[model samples]
Target: MLALGLNQFRKEHFWLYHVKPTDPTTYAAVGVILLSIALLPCYLPARRATNVDPMTVPRHE
Candidate 1:
């Protein structure tokens, strides 16, 4: 919805040179890239935490 609104605003006031603001392929690619960027850091820490022994965690605390 935001993209659509932005595209509308752009269409009314600005000229996009050879760009398609409402392209589905561009949207999907950007969505996937953003999702991967967001999830990678979270996944790495969770994966590392899972590898640690449960018995050792309380000893440190």
Candidate 2:
């Protein structure tokens, strides 16, 4: 659907040709980068949490 929408054009259009297919190497690199980015927030908090002692946190009575 996305490909179709991108490829579909009006009479006066900036793009007339179909977009080039992504290279496997490029795709793999992008996938790895995206995975790392997506996991960053979770990773940092988990790492920080592991390093901290929960007992040190102040408890509200």
What are the lDDT figures for the candidates, one per model?
0.82, 0.62
Per-residue CA lDDT of candidate 1, range 1-61, in tens?
A: 7878778766744335655777777789989999999999999999999999999999999
**Best by TM-score, which number?**
1
lDDT of 2 by residue, 1-61 (tens): 4533553454235334642343355557867999999999999989988986677765632
Worst 10 residues of 1 by lDDT: 10-19
Determine the backbone clash count of candidate 1. Answer: 0
TM-score of model number 2: 0.51
The parts of candidate 1 lying over 4 Å away from their true place are 12-18
For each candidate, what TM-score against the reference? Answer: 0.77, 0.51
lDDT of 1 at 25: 75
**What is the alpha-carbon lDDT for the whole of candidate 2?**
0.62
